[model samples]
Target: MNLTIDEIQDFKGKYPKQIWSLFFSEMWERFCFYGMRGMLVFFMISQLNFHEKEANLQYGATQAFVYAFTFVGGLFADKILGFRKSLFWGGLLMIVGSLILATNPHDFFFLGIAFTVVGTGFFKPNISSMVGQLYKPNDSRADAGFSLFYAGINLGALLGGYLCIAIGKGEIFSSIISESMRWNVAFGLAAFVMVISLINFVFTQRSLGTIGLQPGHPESELQSAPMPKWKEYGVYILSLIFIPIIMKMVSVPEYTDYFMLTVGPLTLIYLFYEMSKVTAAERKKLWAALVFILFSILFWGIYEQSGGSLSIFAAKNLNKDLLGLDPNGVNNSGGAFFIIFLAPLLGLLWIWMSKRKIEPNTIIKFGLGFIFLGLGYYVLFATRLFADLQGITSLNFFTIALLVITLGELCLSPIGLSIMTKLSTKNLQGMMMGMWFLASAYGQYVAGIIGASLVSTNENASNYDALITYTEGYKQLAIYAIIAGVVLILISPLVKKLMQGVK
Candidate 1:
């Protein structure tokens, strides 16, 4: 497996060219995704009239579905359809979904979220695989390439966060605009960004056409024929049965609890089924992947609060105004803006470390991720103390906390899938990747529930509930984050051992 320069040379492209194309493409995709995400919790709790528990449940359910669909999307790309086709289908679906979202802010709102969940399922994973395809195995830069792609994710987040919230919430322009017009403008702008991302990939697919297997692999003895139309159609029909069940769960945010109950046993069944067929080393790899999977979930459960409870804290409590401009609507999406700058530096940081053979092992990196997460939460708790002690609040307090947490995120989130890809065997790659995303499904679900608990008042969000929970929930979350990090760090050696030689 020692990748000599000659082997690596075969896959090399113009690094700058490939990086730029991927960067811009991912930037827009993230913009659309995070733009909606930035507003989701606020929209659900404040605008939707949902009680804290219900809103949180819905938030978790929605995000869970988003990650869960990647399994279906990945199956399509790996088997019947090609990556280009899958990306097109996914992007087109998102555009349609985004449009539906903008059409009206009323009853169909649920429909819009449903469409987005399905659309993201289609889009997220495959495009990422394509970025990895950009580099050859021996090229030492694979991690950096993945990191670059991740930066694109946050770039889009920053744009969406700032622009969408500004337009949707209208603190900057509320005096000059109407709510519906502003909101629609924000949504429409996101749709436009999606279209552009789709366009970039569509035109450029021919260049990397050799990367994804089904496209480049000859139709031969090695290639499996497409599933019969009947079988494909049958799976589609089975999927239809779940649609009603999901719709039925709309009344209960705790539906994810049911999903966990069922998926757990089913997951065990599938693991055994796969393990029965795999070689010993492959089995070890799968088990290793499973170990990382457990830690990964804990990481995201705390990390994803950015979209849930953190957003609310920023909205109702954080002092947004820094230099005297009114800060009311600014907090909604500003974290994304920070990601735009920080993500790339992190990406480059990985590249530099990899070049020097100094990058931390996967488990250690993840351990550090937890540590930073703890520190980030501690920063929040400290900031709360600072606010309470001073009786005067500044946006800087929240900004300081966010900066710390984001740096912690740099240590962990971006590299997770890359770890799974490296550590798992070939056949289980798709399944393990699917599982990785599914972990996020559960994490977001849990985060939503946790976020909802912090939301406080059912009747009015303004101050009545603020008096009840306010900063207390954040204080508690900070403590939870710190403890999780310390525990993960302690177990890092055990987890790293499970990884075998994959690192």
Candidate 2:
């Protein structure tokens, strides 16, 4: 039953068997990741004694570093460590970070978060690049495979998002753990699941054949001399060296802004330099990918409010009787819950449309993503009208908002992953994937600013005052989203031409 890389790529059925291994591995890692994410704002506000505005900025800075590092990680993997080694190293770091937080979240908060930012940088982009390698270029099934992979991400997010928040807030496990220790238990759970993720990957990696081997390894398809011991050691040493530096930057929102401003242009310069070395056709495709990357920054910026401003909104303004659970839990897990059900149906829908020659082009899909995103924000804004005198809104309105947002995500994210692989030259695939996530870093950064601005400056701001401020912000976001969607649709032909026949 041994299968070569070629055989795995060409296997009969809707998905490769290797995908299941990757799916499980990614699922647990996401559990760890989203679990931590869902806890951050609430943890800072409750445990760290941070104000709402400060907590949102901190969340933004932490998340921005996590994603920006993906570019660095991707570049290093492309040049040296390869995907397998990068992922393993990243997982170990993540586990260590989680354990540190579990030990004493209040005192070591930034220190633990810094470690996770670095670990995620190394781990996240590489596995995704490996998934891209599972398919032949231009494979018609690529989108379906990515859609399924996207579902695995959500499955983990769904579990971690709800469970971790519930535990840390002491909504569940109240009898077993003291209220003081619940946060530590939540963090410990993240570390535990990360161990499982690393173990799963270790046992299943044999099935990958030579797909993720180091570039110069003896068994690699490149047929080059082995990479020098010094280079491998150097990458590991440099990552460790950067931990304190990352800690400092992440602790200061101003520093993060400076880092964000510099890193993006520099990344573009590097990409353009690489693009200059490729054929004209490949360059056109890379340009098309860049367009998608740029649009995604705005898409994620608005969509990600659920984790920032909306997280606080759920805790403060929304009714907590959502199925007898915390509204914040619903806010964190709702989109993923919808995605798990929606992804497969949408994947099949794409297949059905393709067979009938009625499938929308990727450009058109991107436009539609924004349209749905705008509509979703409008729904969130509408929650204001449903609020009682105390400013508590209907849980029903919030749930509907998440469903519309999920529809928008289905169009962009999985397709974005698939298109990055298709458009890039093989050598640049990892870096391009990194760039895609780096765009998300920008989105996170902007989302933080937006969230911070919407918060009332008065310490004595009322629930109703907060509700009015936040809902106004949501309305502005909706307008911008609709405008972006219309512009993208109007210019789709130009972008489609740049794609140079890529679907």
Winner by lDDT: 2
Per-residue CA lDDT of candidate 2, range 1-503, in tens?
25567877888888888888998899999999889989999888988888999989988888889989999999999889999999999999999999999999988998899899999999999999889889988777888889999998889999999999999998898899998899999999999999999999998788998887888987776677889989999999999998999999998999999999999999999999999999999999999999999999999888888888999999999896567768988999999999999998898889888879898889888999999999999999999999988989988788999999899999999999999999999899889999999999999988888889999998897899899999999999999998999999999999999998888
Error of 2 at 474 (Å): 0.5
In candidate 1, the residue pairs with backbone N, CA or C atoms under 3 Å apart (3 or more residues apart, or in different chains) clash, namely 31-156, 158-336
Error of 1 at 387 (Å): 3.3
lDDT score for candidate 2 against the true structure: 0.91
Per-residue lDDT value at 208 in model 1: 53
Measured by TM-score, how close is model 1 to the native structure?
Answer: 0.87
What is the Cα-based TM-score of model 2?
0.98
Q: Per-residue CA lDDT of candidate 1, range 149-226, in tens?
A: 676667677667777766777765677778667766767777899999998976565455354444334532235655
